[model samples]
Target: MNDSAPSPTDLLSVGDVSRRTGVSVSALHFYEREGLISATRTSGGQRRYARHVIRRVSVIQVAKRMGISLSEVADVFADLPPDRMPGKTDWRRISERWRGRLEARRQEIERMENELVECIGCGCVSLRSCRVLNPDDELGADGAGPRLLPEIPTD
Candidate 1:
């Protein structure tokens, strides 16, 4: 019987939340600092997190796995009211927003794949091949860079 353990009804300590969610304590701290998750402080100055933060951390993990940047994930969480934990509706809304970004990324990948197939061993990394490599940048109006790829929108 570990008398130091938090009771079932007590808010979870940062370590407890980390153990429950498999997220590092540092990451939890980062999330807290980034405003993706939040916590309260006990009178003794120990931090305490609500159980809902576990689910919130899980959602953040899933978003990261999907190639969504932390800023993008933060934007999604921004849609939720500060007082409420992300619920089913929140998940649905965020998922819908990510669906568009994911689909766009997929299409971009497909385009790059096809382009690479043609660019293989072409050795056309010169401006002379700009017609094929970058038709829009005929005079290098956009400056030096891989201009063929479309910019992925973060929002």
Candidate 2:
């Protein structure tokens, strides 16, 4: 038996959390500093977060990939009370709130699909003939991507 005293299963340190989440420690610190995620402090004042932080970090990464800013992502989780770890139901509710956003994205993709199909059979890339190109229906002149693509709501 190779047992010494079994090593203690320590809680995830800030660095440990970063390694697990593939986010840099500085970014983890930023998340905490910006009030995005919560953590416990040791007697030495080092930050320790629950393992669930992996999932939270994953959410943050996905939201950022979707072009959501940190402040905006923080706003998404702001109403969520951290005293209770979000279960599937809680997460589902949060996702449900984005149903409209997802559907709008879906619709925009469909519009592009039709445009692409049209372009394949005919030489038509004109904004006048394409819903995807003429995305003014969804967006104003402010952001990137198709103007017809609606902006993701910030609130």
Candidate 3:
């Protein structure tokens, strides 16, 4: 093997990326399937990803930790220039959007904390707490399911 450094445009195999980024090959494939990342095929039909995918995968990891969903990540990526790797400016744009989402989530958590404090003296049972939270079975108005919770679409 030559001792020369690889070029910036070199493509990485799925396993190589997985090893470098701590993301599994299966997850990489899933990201590609979800349009969060893209890959090109070689003459033999093997998937190869641009080196920039490492940074992209790292961003995906951080976003998921912050409760950003894959669809949300895809939306953010969609706004970036399609012909190039995401630069600092592109990341900053997405970061600003994510900041808004995190701020909203923080406010929700604070509201829940205050509600729990209010419940402290009630000695409320599980169902009682549900009733107090739901108030007059309001969730039932949503057609017999947990209305406050988001419904996940299944494949």
Candidate 4:
């Protein structure tokens, strides 16, 4: 680390944010336009951001990994104000709101695994009685995907 480089505790310039986040400067500008993040502007119109903003956008990236939409994440952010970065308590609160959703998705995956196992076990290769079947018809009719594909798990 260069002695002249801003400390992690110091506010990061737009270039620093880009370097640390591996997000290009242009994209960061786009994020600002999309209202996903904001930065303070210097008198010369340069942008400066709290180092915590890097963490915020990192969190957003991970959420997107789970198939969350940007608007949905914006809605999540809407629940809390930006003046205070989320501390552990705020994190737990936010996570609690998502816990049910996470659980539902987890259960869906587990059920699908069970269905495939059952299909193999029954010797009939039918998913109708698979323990994983959602009673609400979540799987829909047989036309969905390869109905009985027991491909080698992707490890």
Candidate 5:
């Protein structure tokens, strides 16, 4: 081992964190801005992250893949100490909190799949026959744009 190399317990540079976590340096900075993760500054003004941040970044990546927004990740992270790594107990709590939302998303996707099958079976490509997009032509009265599709809730 090179004596100049950082130890496992030592703080990691922004680039070090990026390479280890496979998350871009820009994303690490973004996470900092969003309060999802934090870092310290070196005497030269370089960013240095705690080694535990690797695990935190992994959690963030998984949550994002599951459709959880950065704000949501921030909310979960807020429940824990910013300076420490999240433990298994912390992860259990976070996963339990997110379970309902993930289930709801799953159900919505299943419903859409069934609706799509029904729409296809009807053999009418028109908006009139499309149950998912416009059921009973109710959207026609609303004056254009998608109607029956679930509206994406904004943060």
Candidate 6:
């Protein structure tokens, strides 16, 4: 046996985890700070992550690509068994939980598409007459700056 070789069960250094997962070291730190993933500290105070954290990082990447917020990912992770890698069943549950939010995003996109065509075809740049912008002058009641626009999704 090669004594120097790391075993599958060995805890990984932050750089090792970053290299293996293709997530930046700073991002790994951010994930830790956000309570998404956790690590143990060495006697020298270096971060050491369990091998299963690779799977957790993968899940974070996938969730980010799907426009899921980190808070939402954290919520899902809170329900997960921390000792093991997330499996097919875990992914299924996560995706199921996100389905409604994704569906709402899809509907929002469709609405934007339909309204975009109308806005362009009408050639009426007036905010008061813009259904896509003012939406029946609903913002008038709010009395605020740039209230003619919908809230842009950040995640």
Maximum-lDDT candidate: 6
Pairs with steric clashes in candidate 1: none
The C-alpha stretches of model 1 lying farther than 4 A from their native spots are 1-10, 130-135, 138-155
1-155, model 5: which lDDT tens digit per residue?
87754564699999999999999999999988887888878889888888888999999999988999888988889889876789999999999988988999899899889888887657776776577876457667778677669989999
Reference-based lDDT, each prediction: 0.82, 0.72, 0.82, 0.71, 0.85, 0.87
- Our model 2 lands, by Cα RMSD against the true structure, at 11.4
Name the top TM-score candidate: 6
Residue-level lDDT of model 2, residues 1-155, one tens digit each, is 33532222535798898888899999998898888888888799888777667778887897777655678667777877664456787678666766666688889888778767766766665655655566563444455555556789998
Off by over 4 Å in 5: 1-9, 123-129, 135-155
In the range 18-123, model 6's lDDT, one tens digit per residue, is: 9999999999999999988888887999998988899999999998999999999999999998777888999899989899889999999998888778887687
Residue-level lDDT tens digits of model 3 in 125-146: 4543454475466556557444
Ranking 2 against 3 by lDDT, winner: 3
Model 3 is weakest, by summed lDDT over 10 consecutive residues, at: 1-10
Q: After superposition, how far is residue 37 of candidate 6 from its true place, in Å?
A: 0.6
CA lDDT for candidate 1: 0.82
Candidate 4, residue 116: how far the Cα is off, in Å: 8.0
User: What does candidate 5 score on TM?
Assistant: 0.74
